[model samples]
Target: MRFALNHIATPKLSLADFLGLARRLGMPAIEIRNDLPDVVGTMPAGAVRAAAVASGVDILSINALYPFNVWSGDVPARALALVDYAQACGARALVMCPLNDGTPVPHGDLVAALRELVPILRQYGITGLVEPLGFPVSSLRTKREAIEAIREAGASDVCKLVHDTFHHHL
Candidate 1:
């Protein structure tokens, strides 16, 4: 089995340094974040691609796009931008996380959002990984829900769930 380090595990490191750490650890891949160090916000996609290539580590993914089930206001824009970035940076996928603020999102809404995102992901040749947050207040709390939603949205080909063990056991 292969293991990849996530940027959140070492939030203090610079992108270059973080990639270096992955290489030093013999990890062939690393997950960068848009939140912890805000790699997506602070650096251009080309730079991210360059750093990953220079270090010989694959960029597994960008940590996430939050509240992806909402599908309104700035969410669509954020999804588009992140998808674009993932494509440009040679990342394989974008993690789509649900809202975690004690609000419930209807199953239809969740499927609708996933449907809306399919074209964008396909356009950029990027995969959408639905990571169900298992927090008490999270709208999506189980992989089952994400899977159903993905199936309902007809996004099975382009979308998949992220089985985060910590969240699963939460």
Candidate 2:
């Protein structure tokens, strides 16, 4: 299996430096994050894409489009923006994360959100890696829940579950 480095593992490094590190380490895949310092909103998509290309690393995915299970309150707009960025940056997928607040999102709502997101993802030619956050307060906290929602939404072709090892034991 090919191992990919998550940007969280080296938050202090600049994206260019991080890409260099990944290249030196022979890791072919890396996940970019909006949460990282001096990255995301601060940098241009072409810059990020160029750095990855220069280092010969594939951007496996963008770390997240958060609170994705909630389709309201600007989430749809954010999803489109992220997908646009991912496509422009040469990233293969966008990681879709669920609500992490204590509030619960209904199962029907979750499936509905995925259904709406699938068409957008397809239009962008990007995969959605549905990551169910494993936190006590997280609305969708397990892969099974994510899987069920994807199946219910008939979004199997557009996305798949992203099982985080840290969240698995949580």
Candidate 3:
């Protein structure tokens, strides 16, 4: 069996070091992050792509666009930017996370947000992995809700579920 690493697994490592670690550990793929070490924020997409190529690590996804349930403020812009980065950096997908702050984002709103994101994600050839945060306060608390929203938005072809076991069992 093969395995991949998430950048959060080594929050203290530099992006270069993280890539190297993945290689040493026999992990051919990895999930980069926007938080903690924040590779997306600190490095250029080209540099990230180059480093991953150099290390022979496939970029599975970018850890997330937070509060993706709401398409307001700069969320749309941020989603575009993240998708652009994922494409430029050779990542196959963008991990789209929902609001986790106890605010209620209705199913209609969730579907609307997914619809808005799908076209952009398609343009970039990046799949959107909707990761429902299962915490009690999370706006989206189950994979069923995420899948329902994705289907309602007609995004089933481009959007997928993360199905985090930790969150699923939470």
Candidate 4:
């Protein structure tokens, strides 16, 4: 497997500096979290793309679009915008995180949400990495649930899972 460094590992660094460190560490890829300081969400697309090219580091994915298994009025549009940004930054995927804090949405609803989001992801040639948060309150607490949702949505072709070790072990 390819080693990928996440922006959370060096939260204080600028995007340029982070990519430089990934290159220095000989990591083939890096993941950028929009929540991280001085990363993609805070920087322009040109700068992010330039930093990746300059450091020769591939962008594996964007850290996340949260509560992606539910849809509100603006949620879909926001997801689309992030997908566009990911494509522009040359990232291969956009991470989709499920609802946390015990929202208790039904599995069918979750699957419906994925179905709604999948075509949007395909529009930009991006893959949706469905991440199951194992927190006590998370709606999706296991990979199996995420897989079920993906299958139900008929999004197997466009969606994959993000197995986070901390969440997995919890």
The number of the candidate with the highest TM-score is 1
Clashing pairs in 3: none
Off by over 4 Å in 3: none
**What is the Cα-based TM-score of model 2?**
0.96
Candidate 2 regions exceeding 4 Å error are: none
* Cα lDDT of model 1 by residue, 45-149, tens digit: 999999999999999898899989999999999999999999999899999999999999999999999999999999999999999988989999988989999
Which digits, one per residue and each the tens of the lDDT, describe model 4 over residues 49-160? 8889888999999978887888877778879988999999899999999888898878988898898998888899999999988888998998899898899899999999
Instruction: Mark the regions of model 4 whose C-alpha exceeds 4 Å error after superposition.
Output: none
Task: For candidate 1, give the lDDT of residue 138.
Answer: 91
Clashing pairs in 4: none
Cα-based lDDT for every prediction:
0.93, 0.91, 0.93, 0.87
Report, for all candidates in order, the number of backbone clashes: 0, 0, 0, 0
Q: Rate residue 59 of model 3 by lDDT.
A: 97
Q: Return the lDDT, model 4, position 140.
A: 91
